[model samples]
Target: MGRLRRKLKKTLIETSETGLSLELRLIGQFIIFLVTIMLCISLILVATGVFKAGMKQNIALFEKELSHLSQDIYDDFGNLSLSSVSLA
Candidate 1:
């Protein structure tokens, strides 16, 4: 009877320990998952802001180039007009 009781007690203790270990592992996994989600969200927000800034810079450069081109065209036209008047 003594040996039987000891065996049962040992089995019970081991089973409880195994259950606790599994619970701890599940909790750790959940925490890791939450952290990963947060990191991804942070990265996306930062990337979007960077992209917007780059696009704005590009647009400003293009506008400046277009203005310069238009000015050049106007200057050419003015030169042509002056030359024709002199010829006449």
Candidate 2:
């Protein structure tokens, strides 16, 4: 009876060790997954901010160019109108 009990106890210990090792491995995998997700989120946020700044700069440049073009058009039209009136 004593030897049988010892054997059973040894078996239980081995089983417990295997379970603990598996649990530890699962926890480690979960931690790695969480860290990877955080890294991806941070990268996406940085990319979004950079894209927004680029778009704003492009918009400003377009507005400035449009204003210059409109001014040139107005000056040309004014000069033509004045010369036509003088001729008439």
Candidate 3:
């Protein structure tokens, strides 16, 4: 009867240890998953920032070109008006 009790105690201990080990493994995996997700978020933020900067630069360039074109149009209109007055 004593040997049987000892055997039962050993089995219970082993079962509890197994349960603890499984829980720890699950926790570790969860931590790793969270870290991976954070890294992905950081990467996406960096990429978006770079994209926004590029878009701003492009918009500035476009505005500059539009201003130059508008200036040319205004000058042409002025010349046309002057020529018409001279003719009149």
Candidate 4:
């Protein structure tokens, strides 16, 4: 009877230990998953910010070129008008 009780006790301890280990493993996996999601979100935000900044810079450059082009067109028109009046 004593031997039987000892065996039962050992079995119960092993079962509890196994359950505890499994629970710990699941918790670790959950934490890792959460960290990965956070990292992905942070990276996406950083990339989007960089892209927005680059787009703004490109837009500014394009606007500057357009302004220069319009100025050149106006100057040419003025010169043409003067030459035509002088010829007439």
Candidate 5:
């Protein structure tokens, strides 16, 4: 009867679980947060790479654009070697 009453008291307790288990749980959560931040940074770099590849144009496109702008400036200038930027 004493054993049964003790078991019942244990089941009805308000405070439970050990400190070691709680500390392990907190450490696991902190590690997850760090990993999540790393993954997010990696994703941002990947997105910027894709954005640059599509928007920066190719070597051929850049050269063709430069040739056109230089031709336009030459027609207007008397004999000046002025540099220009072609922004899109």
Candidate 6:
């Protein structure tokens, strides 16, 4: 009976230790997963921010070029009208 009791106690302790170890491993894995997700989100945000800035610069450049083109067209039309009136 004494030997049986000692053996049972030893088995119980090992089982409890295994359970605790599993719980710790699962918690560590969960923490790692959360960190990975956060890192991914941060990287995506940074990439989008850079893209947005580049787009803004491109839009501004295009607007400036378009304004210059329109001014040139208006001046050419005015000159053509004046020349036609003089010839008539």
Q: What ranges in model 6 sit over 4 Å off? A: 1-48
lDDT of 6 by residue, 1-88 (tens): 9999999999999978776577788999999999999999989988889647788889999999999999999999999999999999
Candidate 6 CA-lDDT value: 0.92
* Tens digits of lDDT, candidate 4, 1-88: 9999999999999978776577788999999999999999989988888647688779999999999999999999999999999999
Q: What would the per-residue lDDT of candidate 1 be over residues 1-88, giving only the tens digit for each residue?
A: 9999999999989978876577788999999999999999989988889647688889999999999999999999999999999999
Candidate 3, residue 8: lDDT: 100
Clashes of 5: 0
Question: Against the true structure, whose TM-score is highest?
Answer: 6
lDDT of 2 by residue, 55-84 (tens): 888999999999999999999999999999
Candidate 4 TM-score over all chains jointly = 0.45
TM-score for each model = 0.43, 0.44, 0.44, 0.45, 0.35, 0.45
Q: After superposition, how far is residue 75 of candidate 6 from its true place, in Å?
A: 0.4
Residue 50, candidate 4: how far off, in angstroms? 4.6
Q: Estimate every model's Cα lDDT from 0 to 1.
A: 0.92, 0.92, 0.92, 0.92, 0.76, 0.92
| Cα RMSD, each candidate | 15.0, 14.7, 14.5, 15.1, 15.7, 14.6
RMSD of 4: 15.1
**How does model 5 score by TM-score?**
0.35
lDDT of 4: 0.92
Query: What local lDDT score does residue 44 receive in model 3, on the 0 to 100 scale?
Result: 96
TM-score of 3: 0.44
After the best TM-score superposition of candidate 2, give how far the Cα of residue 10 lies from its true spot, in angstroms. Answer: 56
Model 2: clashing residue pairs?
none
Q: Which ten residues in a row have the lowest lDDT in candidate 4?
A: 15-24
Q: Which has the better TM-score: candidate 1, or candidate 5? A: 1
